[model samples]
Target: MTFKPFAAPTALLALGACVGRQSVLDPAGRDANTLLTLFAVMLAGLIVLWLAVNGMMLFFNKISTRHYDESTARKLIVGGGIVLPTLVIAALLAWGLSIMPDQRAPGDGLRIKVTGEQWWWRVEYWPEGAATPIVAANEIRLPVDARTEFNLTSAYVIHSFWIPALGGKMDMFPGRETMISLEPTEAGTFRGQCAEFCGASHAQMAFDVVTLPQDDFDVWLAAEAAPAMATDGAQAQRGAEVFLAEGCGACHAVRGTEAVGQVGPDLTHVGSRKSLGAGVLEPTIANIADWIAHTDDLKPEVEMPAYTDMPEDDLMALATYLKGLK
Candidate 1:
């Protein structure tokens, strides 16, 4: 009958999980910090209002022995119900409005275009004055101390672009683009997720946000702009052959190779990314192989077809080649 023992542990577990790298409370960027400050101020104001209103009721109902005069009761009602709340709310609203401009500030130099798909993300980096974008998938890298702007849109249904530690959520429309800027002050890898519900795999649609030093980010951008790495091992060579043979090129692309397809996320530097299948699994050979054979099992309603009938050796070889691309 009593679930009190279970309730305490469950609440603690939930609270503990909230303070991770994905939390808004653990801010790493200017916009996130501003938002956190606003939240703190609003919460403080709300707490004050709650205590004041409840304390008045408690005093009259439980603590007070004598009834107050009509004038005193009228003053208490006006102050607690009308004047105090109005002042607190107005002050909080003004403070919130003051920080809105910074959240909408323009980017320093780097601009990123993100497209939300069925269950994944297509990321393109367009540095200032660049003619073409350097394309990657399911991972975002931002230079520290620079305000980076993201142009977000969805290819299918609506999706909300959100990096909780870095900034607030911006709704991504189908044909129209929405923008948000974030200036990261810390260099760390955090988690990002699609805040909007699109389909069955909405919960699995996630990405990694890696903030790097300016120099390192520049080097990475240069590397990402280049073609995929050459296959060195014989097993990897066989995997490349298998990849082309199986028509994986029809949907996926591997630069420097003939696997040119535009239907899915680019695999040019997939091996170097933090996770695979849009944060559904680690980028390990075993996991890759498992994903290839059980795509739908891992992420329901995903667009990619499972290669369940492929031979074991071919599966391993393909995973090996893809894993070595980094």
Candidate 2:
């Protein structure tokens, strides 16, 4: 039996996944656009050089040896092989380096700090001229056409922060801060993940990134800054009681409620998020209940303890209550 190479088809499938979301090539930010342009230039240069070399090789193979001379050899060797490549490489290097510093966020822009933990992310925003920081988790929001600075660090192991639609990845190290900046030019929702493998759940450690217009972003920030909404329905009240009684409050916080635990993702506005469990599943009542009952099934090797012993009705009530948090 003959074996077929799977590389080409696999590559094609991966390329197909590059356009809709999490694609650096389909850039929505200034930095990603610059990088994409550079990549295109380099790829074009490579194709040109490959064609030129192959064409020359084919020509030489077909030519008679009698026309060859020392001078011709010297010209081809020294000029075509050495001088041209040297100048081309030097120019490309200079051009590439010059564009790198442009990725830095300008002096006047939004500042946010991201701390990567074991399988999750903690996000804090420092608004302009504000004394206190706005804390959130798992999702990030950006303003269109506004420069945003990210201060990255890790609470445990090293993790990489990356939003392919926005910019390049930067490592978050313990006790040291790394920075990167980007300005989104469009309004859309993108996906991001912990580019570094921190633990067993690394593949599931994802986040949603939403970019909006300036006025919309301001409104969102203001709403997120406020306290959590109160539960009204009797079922939601029962769920809240179950949430506290089940000891879920020790690791999560739903602002304005008894669930003021900081060890896990903030649930203050969890219901408003586009996805749940760090993008592992959709934000729905059933999924939330499943996550509570079997987090390891949805995301293997997660640190969250499963509530498999809880009754189905209680789980449903809890999920309903959490969903109403928005």
Candidate 3:
């Protein structure tokens, strides 16, 4: 077989062309760009080394033993093997370590506790000089440009907390706490997921980090800490009755009420949340109704059973009452 010196370059160009058309790479975020650069450099170096090694092996195999003895071939092989591998590995290690963010001091900022459950996340904000922590679930809010420290742990199973745009991942193990700190430089919502495989509903276990302005974050926190409001009008009032009658209180908690079950996400301010089903669906009346009707469809293998048997009118009323909880 003949040697193809241009093969590696052509293959790299082809791969680059394919990636250039991808939506994930087109408008690449900060973390994406960083990872891409790292991968590109590593791949290019490996391809070049592979081509060089294969070319040399082929050339030596074709040559005569009369011209080059065993000692010469051995020397060449040993030198190339030692030097090339050492250089490549050292360069890669240095490059990788250089890209990692400094973890010594991310600065004294907001402290937040993140606890991972089987299929949801509970977040609590501990602001400076606060008597009690402000608690919420599935979604997190932060002030843009403010450095935030997250103390993460798992309540049930082992999970990994990953928000690619902000920083790297941190593992959450039961009884063991890990910390991750990041300064969200932009005001936007970033998607996060459990990078580790946990259980049946692992794919649906997702969350969002919303970076807001200082004033907006303050307002949101104050509102979230307040008590749940009572539903008004005849339909909502009737729905509130349905909420209690349907036995929804078994696994849900509603502030200012007798429902104190902690198996599920707190419904004290479910109406105020941006999304439902642990960020699987938006917080719309229709979405809530669909989720309440068939939660398994929205989140497969979820612990919450489907309420499809419930009457349509009752479902609508229940959704309305839940939406009015804010």
Candidate 4:
């Protein structure tokens, strides 16, 4: 027995349902769910309109053969095609707009700044009643059950910041700022990627959003604000010297040292980050060594040059020192 192909209308409906079940339509969290529901409704309405138009055309084609005067049938078809679709689409547009958040009053929420560069993210936290902002890179930690507003912008090219579990993609345009407000309803680690294609390393440009309980989040924030840990041992001291002497200082910054360049991710507390190389690889000593040795192999268009010219011992020492940055 051979299976038959599905009819066009049935196939379209099935495809629509499949698309609806995905996160882009039926999202997990509350805010995201609301947005997805609105989008799904609009999509479903459009699909219905498409089917109706095709069905009407087929009906007219059949009726014209049987009727001596097909003018009345044509008029009916044209009127229904224009007026009915217009009404349905207008209603859907109104309903979708109704659910969209009001941009005028965003309310009182925790404000954070996210700046997108070539292949990484620069995160800055401005808590309520704080003088100086807390700066971090790649990883973002948010308190569960709090409304957090992100002021997003791009340092170089246009990029989109998206954490699918929390909210929708918000574009980061150069020189101009955009805002995205979301409330993480639960505590968990969610993966985030740069939604737009920015450069050669765009595929490797990923990040993690670690959502924790309010108390845990506060503790982590306090720890992040504290001074960088001091390095001990002869290897680590030598590694620090290699890091400063070998042009790594041109891009990276380690708070208390002379490596104060802002072109690359800050290595001030890099050891504490869950993953290294913008979530491209795990934060192991070996992975760090490989990244330092062959950055181009891991990420071809990364702005940081490969350190393959460095001696193996220097590479090991540098990795060891960076791993001790917590």
Candidate 5:
């Protein structure tokens, strides 16, 4: 009979772990699981304490007719209020602090750099014995069951990078570097977003995270490190002209080509990215056309200019060319 009141609330809390995509309750990595464990321990302790106090109060009220000595009340106050609370808090603090250092990356693990920008994420993979890091934007791919270190930074304003299912939130500040390491336990896809309020399109800034086997991850890194593919058809060649004529080269870059602008994300492998505009839309030709024609309509205050003035055929060619870069 006494346990009935806790049934519904406990059920709901247990069900919270099944939430898909971005739930902290559904932790998938070691670091996040450790946090979830700590939360559960604290919750159980508090609930037991609360029930004990309430039961004592009810017992006292019913025994009001009996002789109640001041010495008993003094003993109860000292034991419950001071000693009990101090011991519980000290134990909880010690457990939580022990989980902190477990999230650090190993000394020789793979390294990746993430730079937070106004409405996008600049991603780079540092492979073994490579002259330059493989660059991508708005997405990260990691090998499952292997430690991966992340060097987080920001170019413009302060931004917080977070993937709730994976681990903790870390701040990215200009001119300073912070680090967080994560090792996914299984192969799957997840979503990441900026936790800080940076600017007008702060809500729109997001990225995709993918985990794969070790062998698959190595193959992907090799492909990403290669030069951008040359256009294969006349239509694509013509589209390259449109990209240059629209002054897109002034801010964006495509590797192995003359379009070298460091201000925007690298489009060397744009066609293969899962989502566009920092995970706002699906990567498709029609969506690409819409994004190019109405850049500000989709993402307000973005630095990219609108290309509504472009000819429909030229726009199609440009879209096809960009899509083929994968």
Candidate 6:
């Protein structure tokens, strides 16, 4: 009886989880809408088939008293047991396969190359016929209504790229590249995750998906292509010195600065990112400092070493500078 009081709210809460930034049911693009439609159609068809079968059983056992002759029973068994199920299954299969080509359609001039690493994403944007790519990490931005193609590969083990609100999942393999195109119809922020289990921190590997108006997306990309903003503040200057002294440049890159290492994520415009540590922590000053001090504690088995011995003031200064890279 006590469970009855909470059942409605609990059910509602579960249903609420099905329609959010990361949910397939709450589609924000054409491919996702198609998937939702196919799922709904199949579910409805199966429900009707289930009721028919059970209803026939109910009629035979409880409602009907007269027994049918052999000929009539055989007809019922053939039509209901075999023919109906076959037709329903075939129709659903055909409809499902027919949408594949559209899902793999070519893009509209923009190509994004994403390389999956141990637990992070390396993202590059290449405009049509461009000689150079604009590199970013752990974030993807797209222009709404324009189909952008993704060239996906992995640096190590396998990883599956999936943005539930936008489209289907694609598997990324090392030494091989795969392609998928997604056209976002809605202008909003969403989330993407590595759908495959790669390593110890597989669950922590997530990325931000942002869809913007075409003009706004162009402005953002242009800014992203430029070098990092100059370090102006006194604290930022000291943080830059600390970054150099600590040999952080050997693994990270801050364009227009001495730190030009590319073994890890590019830090050219890291300050503008929404999250830090490959979406493991928020981009707050305290959180950044904490991540720098305790990388392993926050995200286990990561390649980057923790700066546990750094002085408190220097740690805070570095975090501040990183937070101001925008």
- lDDT, candidate 4, residue 273? 91
Ranking by lDDT: 1, 6, 2, 5, 4, 3
Q: Provide the global lDDT of candidate 5 against the true structure.
A: 0.85
Q: Best-fitting candidate, measured by lDDT?
A: 1
Per-model TM-score, in order, reads 0.93, 0.91, 0.78, 0.84, 0.91, 0.95
lDDT string, candidate 3, 1-326, tens digits = 99999999999887674443122333223444565577788888888778778867777777633577789878888867777867887899798778766432354557889999878998888888877877778988888766678899998889998876666678999999988776665677767789899998898888877878888988988887777896798878878788888888888888777777778788888887778888788887778889989998878777788899999888888889888888
**Count of backbone collisions within predicted model 3:** 0
Candidate 4 lDDT by residue in tens digits, 229-289: 8468898888999998898888887877888888898788988898888889998888999
Q: Give the TM-score ranking, best first.
A: 6, 1, 2, 5, 4, 3
**Best candidate (score: TM-score):** 6
lDDT of each: 0.93, 0.87, 0.78, 0.81, 0.85, 0.92
Report how far residue 137 has shifted in candidate 5, in Å: 0.7
Error of 3 at 313 (Å): 2.6
Q: What tens-digit string does per-residue lDDT give for candidate 6 at 24-94?
A: 99999988998889899999889878887788778877999698999998988888888988988899889
- Scored by lDDT, model 2 comes in at 0.87
| Model 5 residue 111 distance off true place after TM-score fit, in angstroms | 0.8
Q: Model 6 off-target regions past 4 Å?
A: 1-10
Positional deviation of residue 19's Cα in model 3 after best superposition, in angstroms: 10
Candidate 2 C-alpha lDDT tens digits along 241-273: 999999999999988887789899999988899
Candidate 3 Cα outliers beyond 4 Å, as residue runs: 1-37, 58-66, 98-107, 229-232, 256-258
Residue ranges of candidate 5 with Cα displaced over 4 Å: 1-17, 62-67, 128-131
What TM-score would candidate 1 get against the native? 0.93
